[model samples]
Target: MLEIRNLDYRVEARPLFEGASARVSAGWKVGLIGRNGTGKSTLLRLIREEIAAPGKDSPIRLQNGARLGWVAQEVAPTDQTILDVVLEADAERHALMQEAETATDPDRIGDIHARLLDIDAWTAEARASEILMGLGFTTADLSRATREFSGGWRMRAAIAGALFAQPDLLLLDEPTNYLDLEGAAWLEGYLRRYPNTVLIVSHDREMLNRSVTHTMALEHRKLTITPGGYDDWLKLRAAKLAQLESQKSKQDKDRAHLQAFVDRFRAKASKARQAQSRIKMLEKMQEITVPIAERTLPFSFPEPETKLSPPLLEIEDAHLGYGPQAVILKNVRLRLDPDDRIAIIGTNGQGKTTLVKSIAERLPLLAGNRKVPKKVEIGYFSQDQLDELTEGDTVLEHVMRALPKDTPVAKQRAVAAQIGFSHEKVETKVEKLSGGEKVRLILGLIALAKPHILILDEPTSHLDIDSREALIYALNDFPGAVLLITHDVYLAEATADQLWLVKDGKVAPYAGDLADYRALVMSSDREKAGATKASADPAEDRRRNAQARDTAAPLKKKADAAEKSFEKANARIRTIDTELARSGLSPQKMTELSIERGKLEAEAAKAEEAWLMALEEYEAALKESAAS
Candidate 1:
């Protein structure tokens, strides 16, 4: 639980929030929503007391005993094993374990034994293992050095470390950033079951809707906390916008009436006084201020002079990866048609990015034949666009560099303006631009290239919601082939026509909606959850029935076999339950696990009922068969 009272935040003399107050109550799951650069991350730092208030005497206070765990947007892995990092989450436990090992005296040995039992060491390990597995970490991966993994895998380890800590308040900044559909779904489910307070800054709407119970909107230098998710907030905002429009109309009518009176009665002494009073009142009335214009990138591809048939791009028996030692894709055969809007999806390090790079020719293939149309031009927007920009070059200079030599300077400036860069902004050094501005500049440069096939890798990474929507709109209307590798499921759903799901070093094509693809990836976890609950429910009943039947026939043989099966299943259920319990009944976790448990319990109950019905049917069948 945390409380921010009369908070003021500023950056470079610009006020971000003034007199903004909000409370994050215990056990509340809140979605922190705002435009980019609105101080969402700043607010999180304030809550964690990592940064000081602008004023020395500001009244921003955090509740006592509120442990905050934050997952940063960028993750840097140190040289350590994955398991070591995860175990570090329980710092106190690690200390206790170390102390226990060093104790040698008889009296100290007894004390250590008591402490170990009290801490439930076996249960903790089981819980840790379960959490690691859910995040897509195999037992083998746990021993690998973190330095060897990719950025996405490092992010997963960081997230696993935070969740393992089980803090009282979790602040997740774009937790879905580097995750694939499978990893994202797992995290969503895990957050649903979290019991502590949560304040999340994310752009994924579905994740927000499913995980959060409240929405916090930060706009116009103020914070408003409202009940329900983003959709509810949007509805409320629309109503407010309508009300403001109505108010503006009324003010316009009053101004018109006053003007008319002033014009009609200017010569009359008695009426002149009233007109003067109305004019003064109009002067005193507050002027309506329009909201800031939303940033957008609006440009469509130039119509292709000729459309090429068959074999837009083809990869035959290709192996894609970083190097010979770390290949992710082995013998992958892929074909792109003239109009294929394919979306590549998989967990980080699973080769979605490598596959895209291979197609873009950013990396050379180790072993395979890749054929592209003779005249096909490719425009590639790598994931780290900001890093790729020249440091000292101006925005206009960068755009001009991408243009053909025959193009005039005036035409280059005109193209830059169309992408939202103005005269002064065009002259600003590329190093000084914000993330969104960099993305816009890149788009402008890409537009000049006019490639037949466009490949975008996480193009929406730095874009705000409005800009992301605008880019999606442009991509949808483009008249060229596209291969997009992004984690934004909403964007993928809106723009892509086909999905290439990468799993276990193989790509499988799915000819359906993004939702269907998500369902396919999550089906395994859903089935496991269902089976566990179903198998656990009738466990005692079966045990009792087995006990009665064993007494009558093959007493030792049947009893031993039945007991073995019962123990095996019961052990698994107990293990899962222990992990769930250790997650600590936070509001978010409760909502999530309750949802999961409800589904599983429902399925289990249904199966039991169906089994009873089937028993009745089978008895009738036996009677009919006997008669025959």
Candidate 2:
């Protein structure tokens, strides 16, 4: 059990939390939800002990010696391999392994080795690799140094790392933000069967619905916990609110009647006692407090300046990538027109972003042209644009900068208000703005552009549910064409009228909706798991798997590297030997050839030795793989 008693926290003088209390049981996956800046993150920090909860003693308590696993919003990029980075989070396994390797005492080393097996250290790499893959890291990615990955990939690694730790309590903040639908799907399954408690703050509805067994909503400086998922919680909350409102109304009427009795009868000697008693009752009455929902952040995009009928933009056999040589999205034939709402869906790294960039003309197509109707204005919303905002500028300043130079300050403030920034929030520095605020600011800038076509990539990544719903409603009502690429299936389903699937280096229309795609993915995963299980006999499988961990893994890695070098060495010698095989040569040429051959022979000997060692290692791996 976890208890938060008088969890008082404050920002400046304002009480974000005066005295909040919450209790959660073991193994409960609770979805923490609230409006942006409503202290949800702060509550998580207090739970993680990252910050102090403003009380004398610690406000949070965990029974049964529980451990905490927290996924950081940002992590320093490391030079360790992705697999190594994830496995490093399993502190027990890492410690045991280190002790086993370095301890000079045989008894100590034996004890540590036993503990390593107890912690399943031998299979840690494989488990870490699977988790990494589930989060969309490729086989090649598992080997690559973390420093080679982009910030988003590093964030994924962080998520995988925290999951790999498998603590008694898991705190994930927007865990799916860096994930694609598939990755999010994997996460949902992972959390559903998680052995311990989970407290996650995410706007992804599917995740909330599928993983969370409970919801803890922080609003108006109070934390309220209820059983069931987000929708279930909302339904119960609504009913509770309605009941409270009714009670408040009845209480108000009772109080009014009591006051009327007191006014009418207080002057009469016989009725004065009764009136006084009624007055005392009125004074002692407890007011019924009707729960109020948080203030709404309602905003909408400005209508597009231009509208093109069908085929406003068309990409014909287009290929999208960086430069000319690196193509990520290929054979992409997609068309959109005004009134069309298309959501592009695919696994991460399958080039959804690239396809959008190609359609938006932000990146040149590698193979074919994208034809766009003349005078069509495109508003492409990307996180990169948000990154380009001036650091020192205020939210209002960002909007005004995008507006016409002659626009008045009053008009600018109005525009900012229209996009959800109000009062002092408008004057907040760009750097101080929360992620969702920055996203809206970027959207506000786009609203000013008034483009005919809107291309949004992961637009809801930073939005709370309220803001996400608002955006969906606005986009659904918008007249312009929309090309959206998002992992937020809820937002995608709500906003997109048509579905486009990006897969196998091509883009095409998806015949069904997000739900259908989800089913297919789930079925595919099951089939893969089933096939893998069916392929091997259970006892033999365990033995060989253990053998692979003990022998094959190290040997195969060494062998794979050595084979590459051997191939290169042999290729070079072939070229040199072929040159020496020429039929006729001058005496001077012969001398030069003989001398070169001598040097080449020494090099070949060293290469041969290395290659032989590699082959021996590979043979050992093969034997392990084939063990009975």
Top-lDDT structure, candidate number? 2
Query: Could you tell me every candidate's TM-score relative to the true structure?
Result: 0.75, 0.82
What lDDT, from 0 to 1, does candidate 1 have? 0.72
Tens digit per residue, CA lDDT, model 2, 174-227 = 888888888888889889988889999988877888899999988778888999
Kindly provide the TM-score of model 1 when superposed on the true structure, using C-alpha atoms: 0.75
Question: At residue 377, what lDDT does model 2 achieve?
Answer: 84
Error of 2 at 65 (Å): 2.3
| Global lDDT of each candidate | 0.72, 0.78
C-alpha positional error of residue 3 in candidate 1 after TM-score superposition, expressed in Å = 2.3
lDDT of 2 at 5: 85
Q: What is the lDDT of candidate 2?
A: 0.78
